[model samples]
Target: MDAELLQRFNPEEFYRHFLADGLRPDGRQLRQSRAAELRKGALGSACGSASLRLGRSSVLAGVRAELATEEALGRVEVSVELPALAGALFREKHRALGLMSFLSNTLTELLNSPAVFDPAQLAVQKEVCWMLNVHILCLNYDGNAFDLCLLAAIAALEDTRLPALMAESGEVPRLAVAAPGSELVAEARQLALLARPLPTTFAQMPGGQWVLDPCAAEESLGASVSLCLVEGRWLVFHQGGGADAGRFLEELMPLARGEMSKLTRLLEN
Candidate 1:
């Protein structure tokens, strides 16, 4: 084929052509989504932890709790780390700094918001309160970091257990956490988490065909949608793809709902 003809058959065009017939480069059907595997309590040293793998991307989250040392609006803290071992993309001096900063800051802000996770569950009025610190590490970069990180963090929090505070009879009356695995600790409530905002990513091909949960190669190739769903409600709709937003709402909205349902079930199990 001539250069002009080859250019005419670009990857996006070919992908659209195949997608119209329910085919993909990775052999998935047009509406098929990648499976996610979550292993709760994976980190022994941490208070609570979970390791989640979405396709080839891996995210690990650990939840630690301690007495609040500084004044803050909420009881939860979130930090995202993309180490060099995760991918060479993370090792770039300037680029990685910017990307990590954006991810961490955005998630931290959203998590502290009242709608995502309930902070009241972590607080015991004015008497006693514990601050939860969530640390997430990207073990591998295969795209879908936003959704996978949220998945791991939520699962870890759900798996977390806090030791009940015990009153110590001393001159100062210091409070101490009950020993782990003790009867008092066993009675403490598990972290209370609300039904969450599930993230769904879609890649738009040249002919307006949409692919959900795009892989790494698909992500860098073009623009896409990063949407979040909670009980079928659209919490956030981020446009990162070249596709028409109107057409996407008209054609792919139902597909995204199906994806949200699937992800919700995955998190439940």
Candidate 2:
């Protein structure tokens, strides 16, 4: 039987053959993650933007700033969109919506955390402030969407710059769009980030063996556990599939930390 046919017809068995030899079909060892590339400021129209490619999966994140009332100050809104063209699974509206909600909520929580970002930074004054809207779009879906999305979001935020504020007597401060060759352009400030939380995902195979950064085929076979190291703490999110979460963490923390360090260096460059 052809390899692709075998993978499609009996994925579990196909993976078992590879696992027995301590290898994955993608030519990676069990603990190896796919090569990743991150490019910041990918979109000129947005306040800030980034494009990321992890193996075959691709994601883009853009940050836009809008004026907001005191009640909405320091509020960051996140939305994730998975078009049908991204993958077959997204063609099912309900499934796509569910995933989108999960990703959006997760990102919102992380970005809003004081440990990750300071609400005070968004404050322009007492009555009004800046609200950041982060929009994430999945360009391709080979698997591991959570990791890709989070990385892209963080990179975009790091690339963001808050426009200069112009104040008139007795009026609320408003964003100033600097004209070309204007001095106001130099007044823009880079968005300050308190921390960067990088995520590493592992998928449990049929025999309870965990593989890091599973592709689409491997993901369909088992549950996945995603670990984000945030300021010396681990944030764990597990997708259902009967895997042992505790053991997965205990055995994988060292590897996850190393991956996080590499990601940090990537963002710095």
Candidate 3:
């Protein structure tokens, strides 16, 4: 179907289908997320890698560790893009660029959060720190890209294995970089994962209906609310245009919080 025609389609029928069956069109309960699958160490060259599948959606994450000698203690740059193959309809350059901008801004905030990661650990010398680069690729974006991206990034970092570091006795603050094939002798440190807890997205229909983790079709028809809460320290909540956005977020907070708590355990291993 063409983009215009797809956008013209109404979601009342789909909502009715869910109401009649007490389940979503995709056969999920109101609070249930689609099935999720996680595979770690998928990229051989990266320090850490993982592929994630959430129902029809797919995302991959890779982590690279580089030496940072610059004076800036902490610097993180996140870029997200959708390839033409990922979404046949979104092949335009402008669309891809806009998506990258959005994802980068969202991720940079987490990196800047002081509670998430320690900048001092990256220091190799008196003022040198390691630069950790994390890349998240969206293979297929059925919906809920933010939540999926965050999850994939965390999973990949958890799987990351770093190399050994040794200080050199030569002049200045010198050190030998570890070869990839060398034995694992470096002390591993945790990646800066923002204390941000779980991410739950809600799609609010015209009336009072609120759907969690809406598919692409539902998302096109209604407004969305994305909430990320980290236990007690932080909450990053965003709402997009759709009717009754105020009520939806207020009522959905507790429910979304519960789901996030459950999802956090999946990242543990």
Best by lDDT: 2
Local accuracy of candidate 2 as per-residue lDDT tens digits, 5-100: 998899999989999999999899999989999999999999999999999999999999987765645778899999998999899999999999
TM-score of 2: 0.93
lDDT of 1 by residue, 101-202 (tens): 766776676666667777767664364577889999999998867788877887888888876765556898555676654444224668866667677777
Q: Write model 3 residue lDDT over 182-221, tens digit each, in one string.
A: 4443555655455644678877655557778877766666
The weakest ten consecutive residues by lDDT in model 3 span 1-10
Ranking by lDDT: 2, 1, 3
**Alpha-carbon lDDT, every model:** 0.73, 0.88, 0.70
- Of candidates 3 and 2, the better by lDDT: 2
Q: What is the lDDT of residue 242 in candidate 3?
A: 41
What shift in Å separates residue 243 of candidate 1 from its native position after superposition? Answer: 2.9
Q: Tell me each candidate's TM-score.
A: 0.83, 0.93, 0.83
How much is 135 displaced in model 3, in angstroms? 0.8
Q: List the residue pairs that clash in candidate 2.
A: none
Error at 165, model 2, angstroms: 2.1
Off by over 4 Å in 2: 168-186
Model 1 residue 122 lDDT?
Answer: 69
